[model samples]
Target chain A: MSVTTPTGFRAAGVTAGLKASGRPDVALVVNDGPSHAAAAVFTANRVEAAPVTWSRVAVADGRLDAVILNSGGANACTGPEGFADTHATAEHVAGALGVSSGDVLVCSTGLIGERLDMPVLLGGVDAAVAALSDTGGPDAATAIMTTDTVAKEVLVEGDGWCIGGMAKGAGMLAPSLATMLVVLTTDAALTAPELERALREACRLSFDRLDSDGCMSTNDTVALLSSGAASAQVDEAQFTDALTRACRDLAMQLLADAEGSHHDITIEVVGAATEDDALSVGRAVARNNLFKCAVFGGDPNWGRILAAVGTTDAAFDPRTLDVSINGVQVCRAMGVGDDRSGVDLSGRTVHVLVELHAGSEAATVWTNDLTHDYVHENSAYST
Target chain B: MSVTTPTGFRAAGVTAGLKASGRPDVALVVNDGPSHAAAAVFTANRVEAAPVTWSRVAVADGRLDAVILNSGGANACTGPEGFADTHATAEHVAGALGVSSGDVLVCSTGLIGERLDMPVLLGGVDAAVAALSDTGGPDAATAIMTTDTVAKEVLVEGDGWCIGGMAKGAGMLAPSLATMLVVLTTDAALTAPELERALREACRLSFDRLDSDGCMSTNDTVALLSSGAASAQVDEAQFTDALTRACRDLAMQLLADAEGSHHDITIEVVGAATEDDALSVGRAVARNNLFKCAVFGGDPNWGRILAAVGTTDAAFDPRTLDVSINGVQVCRAMGVGDDRSGVDLSGRTVHVLVELHAGSEAATVWTNDLTHDYVHENSAYST
Candidate 1:
């Protein structure tokens, strides 16, 4: 799957020197003529980035021409200067593309409260505009990354429509839609309203459900743009299905790359009294740092998982709950899992499972193990 | 404030050779009283330790003769073997004290799913009984610790009544009350039913409010026993006041000893629309690892804090929220805290204040910084 496999969109990624490591820092995607219908989701964090503000204003008309993204300086908490920086970037992009400035969207991700060097950002925008081409998907994917080890790109080819997406985020990922900045491009002739509905539904099942580090970012944004360049007419269900699948793939990639993560765990809570209960239990485990650390240690500490589940309001009889670590049934009927013999946990990754035995509904959440690196990364710079 | 300061309660602590470090591992506390009123609370986590199982049952009647506690083996997830181990430990302690095993409460903390060595545990029990004396409080305090830098104890004197408590827990602390195992002694006479009411209330305000690492322990217990040696008649309010003060003091001590903690931060959400809203916002910050890490970095990244606050269900315009870091009012009406100049996060301990400006109600939660040692201690273990 690739993000630009959709019909009318053209994409490009280029370096702007935003990151000292000299990786690509600017990504530009454009709807080269046709329906520029668009919908965007911004971070729930009250501390928004400059780009979030600019994008929110651009979506006022429910139509968009392009998205310009940068990675490195978050351009957040820089006061009025950050706002001016965003406005300048979007205005420059829109002027060059001969579209309304309001039609140009922007996004940013990096260290919070840091200012972006305007000269580098402006030069990067110029390079991005010149480098824009229909098939430059890899470049676009590589541009919007701060600390991500690898770029994320997903493209879906449908009968009537095509969808392509690129996302950048590794840490500060959790529910509340995670800390990602994702852009979805489609060649289907869809309206802004329809795009909003489909995007929200797809996100609910994919991006919104991926809980990695349990911390939300101030610069989270997801934008969906339609190029209206497809030849066939794909139905709504087909489009949404393809969209969801693409998002799921990217979300999984992001989870795998979560910082300081030693384990890629998938917690499946089944037999819950309700789907809500299942999710509640799943989230409780996903957000538990201690439990995550235990997984990092390769310890099948199912007791920690059980404790996390019990802390939730979800209804269940502790004695009735069943737990399995890796495929070993270690807790049953609230008593204990049967297999405690010869348990080995000296592995890089581990899987833990819990069953409520209360009902038939189930849900799975993906997460990473907590490790010493995570603590070192978070604690070392105490100024 | 020390556990030994309480009236009419005898305690003994000794190293049982059960721990590889040769540290104190076993403790005994007895009430020489005219009343047998006792109350207790256990970990809300469904996966409880073996000692937790026995103590939970024994506390149902709210009347206990003695409490036997040990460190080094949590007796959790040992399957049926763990339960049998709990029974044997209780039986051994009972034999030494010449009391029914059911009259003794047991608590153990350390590694999960590890079986207790019966010989070492039994010998420790005998030593605890022989050394049980009111003056042995300090020994008992040292006997029940795992990763704790210092023992936690509190003493409070009220009119005709005294309250004293001791607790042990470094990690697995958060809502549902951090994983603290506490034992309280009182000289006031009360029924088991009354003691339960008071203890629950005290926990709600004290232990339950601290949201440290957000990990609930599998083996948490709080037992309160009355020695019935108060010199004069006392009112319920007087007894509760003293008990509450003691519990709060112990809770603070626990926070002070929180493993891998750089800051003992207090997040106060004021002017919320409701108590639940205030609490949700407060807890949202308490649980935000990025914000915690940012504070650790001394960046005064108030934006991350606001971003965390925005993700909650609490109602407030993002821009209208006011945030303060280290007593420096950083964000006003949803804007940047501007003077990032004076935001002092240099201290190992930090306090953050968030004003929602939605209502008059306020809520506070305590938590610690995200640090490397926490990860090291947790990740190095393999169960």
Candidate 2:
């Protein structure tokens, strides 16, 4: 259940003195391969972090030798000076690994608008490189955590190759990615283009559908590194399926540990005029603070669901909408249907289904219920 | 200061037994004048309340002899039966006033997806009409509250003419209107068309720009009635200005009494490419949960503001953006400027300024901080 579960990968995690808690804060993952093919997706937010800007160009040629990540300061909104810091960090890692700086990708997560401590961060990077081992995946996963309470890792085995992945993000989870950093390593015989296509499709279905708090981040990165050591030349469809499953697993782990969340909600929107309409309706409901709060209180308040759907321009007749909570059809034909008291919400997982009665297309989005702890955690997050 | 502050208007409030707490839940306002001209705006949500649909048509011809409002049930999402209830309510009011049913407007607020008790509501309406008085403005304001903590009323005096207004909404305040129900009255002489134009402009600059929680409601209405009793024949521009001032004053009251809020935040976006751009930017910041939480914690986290501004498509160079919390310029040129410690946010009101440096346009939006109490109130609201 770690990145080193795959062949041709070495990883390490070390303390960086950047965090006030004195925990491990720097990680390094290197692909030792006869084939170094890579693909990545960064935050769509225009005001991106310095590391995102640097890594986007590093992975553009579909190749990378190593990835260096730190968790303490996000290095975002720091202007040119911040960008220069990221460049220097990459250069330092490249020198330690004997690889070109252009082949090294960097990722950072933590409070935004602050610069990283260069001397301390550089010392940690040197220590991480020295401690690199094939079984260091779990350590690396633990190092890249900011608010995450647990380390998220997954492994998917194919015919002759396997994929290993790790993710770190607890808050600011939203569409177009959250404040997350995900790294996937695989020992499969796939080219750069194939890996890119598979990674994009997998992320679109997994991470893109999770909106914990509707807060987009400035430093979201998901990178896939392929080392063709298995020499299995697997089918593209099969590879894509395995990659998607791994991503979904990590996404669920993130949802389970979202900041101050009480319930994990899966909103399924069906019978829409189009898939986009279904997604639009689902996202609108998922982002509604009132609906989330209702779920947190263990109340089957289907009225708030319909009101949220009404705000979207999705194709749906107001009078024909139907809503079900946890298998209880609380609302039908836009009015009260079954007894809301029959619905059971005294659990951590909840399912909300909305039928638009427009068409056959459908989509689903995942979210977390708003709770008092959410407000408390976020209120003093930067302080 | 309320709807009855103006000449030729009488209002009353009475218990309807609609609320479980036995609070006054019915209100009536009568325009007893030689000229009855009115205009109104309803929520933009597609699945609007039954009363909104009824009042939209009743005020289409720019004439309203009376306005009836009720709390404890929104009368929304109840299908045809809900529409029938609103129609019957208008007819009852019309019968009491000896006027056409189309000349009476109805408004309802409270929980959605529930039917109102017609017998109890109608009895309260009769009592309210019989108890109508010239000094009943404060009582009428109190009667129309759902979760509001206090009555909101304002009066703006002009040249022998005055505009009086009242509003009630504690949560679900958003753009395109909130869960608010507002009533305005004026004795200034003006035509229906003129009243419509002025009311729209006044609402656009006042209530429309206040977004306390970013949750649009299905039952929002702002109605203005002119009795033309003072015979002032006021200037159109002056009347519009006074009306806007009254709306803004009531809006501030709503902001001050928002549900479970700790701080009232005013976000001002300047140097935008267009007025719409400024508004979009301001609304994005106002709606960001992280930024709202930062304000609640009294942490001057300006990076969250920049991250929110980056999410919008507004034309602005990311490198040139500036953000100020309270009066401290915490961020300049997209990077750290003044020390965040220099900023002060221990007050109940906060001012955030963002300069785009893209053009010469500006806009402002009002919101409230995200606090634990907000989550608590909303989570258990309908439970």
Candidate 3:
């Protein structure tokens, strides 16, 4: 169980013949609820996909009955025709589910500059609706993948209600939103505005700090749907906490399964004057390709770390900065500390700590190292 | 002939036993001038090298008699000991050349966070001064290389005056101050302010646009020395043009030799609302790891280019932007224009033109594709 782990949700995935690989390419999640409330966040990239445009308007009224996602085509940069395709797909979903077209959301992921195979995708929507089951969550998760080697799904149980989510991405990941497609569901009774606030706060700390490749996708979208079937009136704080936990779990899974990643890096920036400064400092180091490559090679290159930190306008004195890797203080007071050869980097998880000596604020950013496989995976062709 | 092409300049490079390879590790360039007017730029990185700290103050009065550079140790992040080494080296150079220590500029480039070997480096400084010759520019050029495959030296002839320079940098190259150590010599009659204006303008257009790996270095410095020995009165425009040409020549050489990169990419942004916007757009694309990897794999992935452009705040309508790779308009009006398969990437020189369709402003950025060799070179132990 994934999204359906939260009650009053039915999901399905079916082959649409949209991908050349003949894999399942379409998925649907229906909110069969006494209350249908939803909120969504989209990629800030000015070049948004056609489905993102349709879904943005659909979620504006804060009521969504169903979300239809296709994995074969991004439906981005396809001009007016692409928008029409997304509109038609949403209308088809609404007609099949006996709801208004505006109540249905649409999402797409794949190549950026191509139109969707509308006929196959629409037919697959019919099959997906017919196959919607409470236990179809696993298939739905698998349907959204492009370059991902594994499906990402998470469930966080509250006192009585639960939050669950599924995400798919591998490359084109950076800040503001690491490139990915995500869908979250909860059984707790809540309004659309509450869900919006909770989802925004959750994503800001979870998905927004993952800089895998420093590439932002044009079709990135994350949506949250809630149904009051459980009748569990959860507290606002509890709801946000559970939602954030689910999103973080899914985000960590995505990082672990990032394409061609050899090491998962956690960059922790402490002693910042503000949260934004900490985030900026962490993200700068996270996105530094040279630093990432050094981590991949198991080279404890702290100079690259400080160089990355120097590029940011974060509050910190360069001469007073300190760095520790895996609990070994490699750089102290902006100078050499421990012997680099003593630090062990043969594990999959690499932790880098930077002390700015500015204030009490701190933030952590997750990233992956640059490797030959990363180049090979990204440079082969468009997904 | 390189820096020695200009009159009133003597340069020498000698082995200092500081490098394990016993290669020439010390270099000295002296301005034997009636007018010792000079100007220089240092890395904007807050964590600057000890030599950058010393040279910045030495050139503050806009006059310098000599510059001493070493290649085996950067003398950066070594705290007080590193600063002490730089101070001692400068004093030794000033004593040998019979000039005040304040008139001697010092530069060091190699592994950061390590102090230079004082005895060997100072001895090489003495040997460098004894061996100074009018035609030793090539030797001085060879002495400053770290990871560079070849020495980079260029001379540009003005109406009556000539501008010559030598540059050394193969990695950690980025905007504002492309990571490198450069020495420029001109025998034209000019004041310190004239030399400063010309050098700044030249670097802004040339070196400032080369973003190799999106990593800034702690030891980047570019110095311009005017001896006023040619007795030639050159026009300001001619002098700036010649200086720009020389810098551009050395900048290109750095790109060509940029740490195992196979393709030299020139990203030109046209029809922007402002030059800064154009540069921002081009640099965003140049620094995108996904796009660079695609270029390295010989894949014509135009989607990666647009995705990078979308990340910037540059002025452009994503729906109206156009991209041409190697003269093939692969993306037009933000949609697929030509068959990506038609774009040939077999050559070493790759040209990507992005049209913002906003206004008349244009800018160009030179970069290299992310390759396996870049990973291998950077992942290995520090050179």
Candidate 4:
């Protein structure tokens, strides 16, 4: 139970026959709330999908009664007709729920540059509404998956309130956001501004730090809705902490299931002048193909790591830098230190620690190793 | 006859016993000139190799008497010992040629973070100096190779003068320069400043635009030396054009021989507000792993192209963008246009043209497709 784990929420998933594989492809979640408060973030990419444009405006007034999502064809780059299709999708869902269309949000994912099959989608939406239940969160999560091997869900229980979230993503993951769709629900007494603040802060420290492939997408959305059914006024700090935990849990799940990835690597950048500098340095190393390939081969080639770090303008003395793989310090002061053969990388998780010795600030970024399956999976994705 | 195609220059290649494969690993080139004028460029990566640090200062006075290059170990990330090794090699060369130690430049390639075998290297340097002759250019071209499959050579002839060049590189190729070692010789009567101007312009248009893997190296150098043996001065513009052609030719050769690459991709961005904008957009697409994978799989996934273009800050309207793969306009006005099936990517060379429709300026960036072999080669490279 993810989105529906919170009180006053109902969800459903149904088959739409939109996918060639004939998988369940449509989902709906509704909030019956004493307080209708919402916050959302979409892809920063300029070429946004039709549903992203539609939902962005829908949540501008800080209210959302429902969210509808689908996984079959990304309704992106389909022009004006695509936007119209998104509007029609929300309108159809609103008509079934007896709510205004302006209070509904929409999301779509899959292959880009294609139109959705509206008749089939509407038929599935009708079925989903009829099958809505408080235990439908698992099905909803599964329905929104493209290449994901498993569904992701999280539930954080407070004293009298709770936060629940579900997410779906597989590939094309990067910083600024991954190619993912996420929905969160909370049964707590909170205003829209409060929810927005917590959501932004949580996402910045969680999803924004995951750089699986260094490829941003055109249809990434994360949203949260609140219902005052719990009638408990929780502290803002508590809410933010729970939300961050949920997002990070889901992000790690996404990293584990990233397409064709063999290793989940965590790059911890310490001793920086600023958090931004640490992030910049971490991202540079995370995106370096040479470094990623070395990790995949389990080669402790610390020189590639230093070469990557040197590409950034972060505050660090090159001669004073240090790097460690796992628990072994392979490079000391930018030179070979301990024996590389002592460090083992034949595991699923790898840790790389970089000490800049610039200051006290630090940041961590998560990524995956480059592998043959990564190339094969992506190369044959659309085909 | 690449470097020796011009007059008043001698070069030689010798076995250094540095590489495990027993390949010729040492090369020497000297200017037996009436006028010795030189200009050189090194990698912009801040974590530079010891040879790069030494050569950059050696050519600062715009006069180079000789250059010594070695393969099998890049003296990088080896600390003060690496710098000392480079200095000792240059001094040895200077002693043998009866020139100032400061007038000799050094270059090294292969694996980083390792020390050179001084006794073996010094003996090979002696052999290289004694074996140096005007007809030794071919052997010199073959010596400074890391993973390169073929030697790169170019010769441009003028009315009374000629320019010749040779280069070696294969993987770890990217913008800001590839992991390459280059030597260019000219028999024309030119000054140091004029040669610098021409060399800069030539590199800016050619080597700078080739970004094979988006991984900048710690050691990349291109040096141009003028012997002034022909005693005939050519127009600066003409010399620049000839040098640009030679650089472009070598750059394309590098692209063709890039490790594990299946296709050579040319991303052309047109109708931008400025040339910089065009290049910015082109490089964005060139470095996008998703787009590169699509090309390797022979999939005309134009949506990935538009998605990559949207990530840039270049001047462009998202809705007005157009993309064509080969001769087929697969996307128009940022939507599906001609059928994607009409585009063919079965050939070795693939062209992707993007029309921003923001202005008239344009630029092109060259890259290689991501393939399984590329992953295989790089993953097991240092192992």
Candidate 5:
């Protein structure tokens, strides 16, 4: 009941013989609604996947009857042939559901530069459509796994309506979205414009702040579909809040299950001149591989943090900056403060707070420690 | 006979007890010059090391009598105490040579945010001064090693004069100067201004282009000292060419021995609207950890390369871009082309060429493949 936990929605997951592991690889979510209101966000990368290109046009009219996603062989860099494959997949889904082809969005993930196995994929689509049920949300969430260790699902109930979402990503996760595939379902009576506004706001504060590996994917996509079948008229602020909470919850799941990560680290940057400054500073620190490795080693090396911070253009004089690891103020006034030996990083969760002493704005960036296993996993991945 | 390959220079390397391994950790190079003309470049990082701050001021007059460098402690983020330590070390060198303290430059590398051991450091300075000899260049190069597996040294003769240099860096190497310490000596008769222009031009094409790990160190410094002993007023172009060759040689050496790197990768971006655009594109691909890891796995993953190139503001149409690995044009016209299986990556060198199809400019960035050894070395370093 993940996606269909809300009224007037159904989802299904089925094996598509796309993943080498023989796991479920095809997922579908549908809306039987009096109103079809939708919004979507895609990867900012210019070299986008064929599915992303198709879905961008499909969801342009702010209505989507269904979304078909597959886990293997991202149709990216496959030229004209890739786009044709996406179109064909959407057409098949439309024919099965008796909906217009233009109202069906297709999403594909996995290895880039390869075309999908159309026969296997189309067969899985038929099975998914047949298996679609109100309790199929968890299965749909499991179908999109690449390197993800676990399925990610979230539900946030508003005053009278609810929003449910499922996300899948483990690596190639960065701001502006990760190598992720997400689908959201809601029963709130809102227009497409309202859903779009709420989605942008929700992602700006949630998915847009995670920079796990600083690698953007070509197949990143997030879509929202509202059925309005519950007849629950929700206010804009309340809907936005619920969406943000759902996205944030899924984002945390992505962080917690990042491949080969030994520790989940949160960098909270405060006293920034602006929110962008805070985000920029946090991202610089988040992408610093050396700092991530130090954290993986459980070494409270605040100097690495300062070195990373100094690389950013954020407002703050080097002499006035401060850094605290866990609860220990390891560095103050940009110099050695309390003894670092007192800081214990034996836990899996690490919190780093950086004070810029420039303004009142603040932001947090979530990331994972770079570990030897991460190097090993990634080094042997495609080979 | 590295730095001393050119006339009128003496150097020495001595153990300072600063390194736990008891290896040589102190180096000194003195310009026994009839003409004290010099040029230098330091790290662009705002949070510079104490030695970098001190050396900047010392080299401002364009005349340096000697340069002293140490390993085992970076002497950065130690605040006033660290700066004072750098000053004291310079004064000790100045006193030993009877030169002005203002003319003595200093450089240090190793762990950051730690104060140097003044007693052992000063003792090593005395020994270095006592042991200085024209043939001590090789030792001086060896003493500067941090994680470097081999000492980098090069000699190139121009006209009647000659230039010789040494460099040390195994990680944290990037543009705006690699995380390195380099000392160059020449016997050419040139003024400070001329040397400055030539040095900057040479470095801009060599050391300033390598982005090994995309981590900038706070203690990077490169210096060139002329003794005017050979009195060879060679053509400026000839001198610049020789200097650039020497610098490039050392840069390659640094790249070959990068920490835990199994492959020396070169990313060449061509057909950009401007040289800067080409450089921006190349640097983006070079710094992409996922692309680097893919290369380590011997995977011809051109999509990762394109994804990284898209992050840059370089002029290029996504649909017209092309990527080639080794001699195989795996991606043509932004789509799949030749069979990637034809590409052989069994060698230690990997070349990735990207054709932007935007204009007539091109640039190359050298990097290293990301591997588990790199993660292990860095993660266990500070701890």
Candidate 6:
């Protein structure tokens, strides 16, 4: 429930009228500790947002004291004006915190390629600075939101360290890391290089493979900030466990809030020749719009799974592939076998199990069913 | 206008009441005589429909005498029962035509993983045979359609050889080719080997690069049957041109009928390092649902285009990328360098011009916008 409960930092979320809905617009979380180690992963999209640009620069330093997140304006393709707004925000936040502007990270989520309302955003920045408190973690967790049904914040209490984070994504998600924006706070003591390495590993397994509809975004970012408040150095095992749990929990929340999503689907690829192959096959199925539509219809169309898998170069004999939908084996040896009447489509949750008959390692990722709401929400917006 | 206008064939179509919509569901096209040669391509999906399996084997011999197509049932996941249905239909058609069963090609389009309603299909097969006539081309075109607003049949008078074909793909279309069933008839006298070589070359540039939503299907087939009716032995150049034009026109029609399409989009990539680079970059943009949504909303959101193109492996300096939307230069040298005031998205058609500036090869592909109609149509049916 608390963003600070899992780690060594304080966060504050405040509403400053940036959004007409009167939701929180500004969130500031500071790592107040003996360690300033951090790592971050940014969107691979060429059209980067201003905040992503700022975060990329900050993450290069391998350390961060604070992250300033604002919703209601994506600060994306607004040309030079967008960059100026980001710089001005960092300056204002740094002035208030009495810290270097260069050390202050920034991220924004909302409409893409739009100019931020400097008057409103700057006002939110002032209010955020004024409202910052050691116990404002919950508010900060809810501040950076855009069309999300609820604030996505996760807290994990580890044996030797703590990890907490918040995420925002209701649309525009796919590999190459779509519009997902996250800020992870931890109390574990580590250097910038270490944070970068660990964050990439976490993202590779957790975020990078999370595909919704294969549309890459211009403002996808995931940042890690550590305060070293725990003081004790947590070993790599505990650190990864905490990071994994926090990311996993947050990732699911993102899936749950996907635009126009009904059924939260999970595809588990088992018995693959390699983890990459498993992921490749799984991602292929996840991105297939026709398959997702079938899931939305609750048709239990498992043939689409094999059809999607066949398009990949992953090593597997199609005829040797086996597929099960919600515990019912709909296909065997890469071809349709038994009557799918055994499978029940009444359930809201759809699960696809694929066996490659190659090796042991498996991978699973979550996504939501594609519905008219997704198309409506996305198409309704002019950009 | 005529399926047999291409080279050396005759065709027919008939209504057999297999479709609940009371539409035509049986079609047949046959080569006249002269030891006709042929080459064909089948869907890459592993979960092929029963007819796909049958026709792949039939066309594997590099010769085709007749092709039978139905629109009501896919005969996809009926297991052995489905194969039995395909075999029964093929055998019946071959018997009526006085030809070997292996020489008959087949295609089915409808819902996936469902039985072919064997009795109804067989009745339709018999009716199709009875309806066969030298000039029944339009009826044949009408018989092989499902959810299509109009039947897609083309007739082209070539220099030395004429080419005509009918294609059906209202949805489930992408590069690897999903559920796109096409049958071409030509009267040119050519060897099966030469036809094979020309068809592959034509397909790579025409059908292979077309992407709607990037989802491949399990029921795609494109078979070119030669009747050896023409006395002149045409060279490969003329054959390739006519073949490419026919396939390209069909591909365009498919894109125009894309499920839930509001706008027909053309992605033109020029100055790419290689044709592959051009295609990869073009596909990345063409498959982006957000861009499709934006196009539907009539917003010339160039940022989305840049974001999509940037995620590709095509070698290009993202900083040096140039984009022109509707001939209005928006981005230059990887940055916004010109006025975007000239962008007009008020029309139902859009053109996204991308310049990699890497080299001198250009490619154009047609796609449609992602709309609520598309989601509704695709998800509403179990197929």
Best of the candidates, DockQ: 2
lDDT of 5 by residue, A30-130 (tens): 99897799999999998898999999999999999999999988889999988999999999999999999899989998888877899999999999999
Provide the lowest-lDDT 10-residue window in model 2 chain A. A330-339
lDDT of 3 by residue, A245-331 (tens): 888898899899888899999999999999999999999999888888888899898888988898899988889999999888988
Chain A: TM-score in each model: 0.94, 0.99, 0.99, 0.99, 0.98, 0.95
- Estimate the lDDT of model 4: 0.92
Which residue runs does candidate 6 get wrong by more than 4 Å? A6-8, A16-22, A78-85, A176-178, A191-194, A231-233, A335-348, B6-8, B77-81, B159-161, B332-342
- How big is the positional error of residue B237 in model 1, measured in Å on the Cα after superposition? 3.0
The C-alpha stretches of model 5 lying farther than 4 A from their native spots are none
Model 2 DockQ, alpha carbons vs. true complex: 0.81
Selected candidate, larger lDDT, 5 vs 6? 5
**What is each candidate's DockQ, to 2 decimals?**
0.50, 0.81, 0.72, 0.78, 0.75, 0.53
User: Predictions ranked by DockQ, top down?
Assistant: 2, 4, 5, 3, 6, 1
Which pairs clash in the backbone of model 2?
Answer: none
The window of 10 residues in a row where model 4 chain A has the poorest summed lDDT is: A330-339
Better by DockQ, candidate 6 or 4: 4
**Interface RMSD (Å), every candidate:** 3.1, 0.9, 1.5, 0.9, 1.1, 2.5
Model 6 chain B, TM? 0.96
Candidate 3, residues B1-383, lDDT tens digits: the string is 48888998999999989888899999999999988999999898988888999999999999999999999888888887889888999999988889999999999998876667899998999899999999999999999988899999998887677888899999989986888999999999889998999999999999999998888999999999999998768887788888898999999999999986999999999999999999999999999898898898898888888988988999888889999999999988988789888989999999999999999999999999999999888888463
TM-scores for every predicted model: 0.91, 0.99, 0.98, 0.99, 0.99, 0.94
Question: Model 4, which residues run further than 4 Å from truth?
Answer: none
What's model 4's lDDT at A129?
Answer: 98
Query: What is the model-wide C-alpha lDDT for candidate 3?
Result: 0.90
Error of 3 at A193 (Å): 0.3
Kindly list the per-residue Cα lDDT of model 4 for residues B1-383, writing each as its tens digit: 48988999999999989999999999999999988999999898888999999999999999999999999899988888899999999999999999998989899998887788999999999999999999999999999988898988889888899999999988878777887998999999899999999999999898889989888899999999999999777999999999999999999999999999999999999999999999999988988888898888998888888888889999988998899999898888888788898888999999999999999999999999999989898888887
lDDT of each: 0.81, 0.93, 0.90, 0.92, 0.91, 0.80
Q: lDDT per residue, candidate 2, B1-383, as tens digits? A: 78998999999999989999999999999999878999999999998989999999999999999999999999988888999999999999999889999999999999888899999999998999899999999899999998998888999999999999889999989988967999999998898999999999998999889999888999999999999999666999999999999989988999999989999999999999999999999998998998888888888888889889989999999999999988899888988788999999999989999999999999999999998889889889886
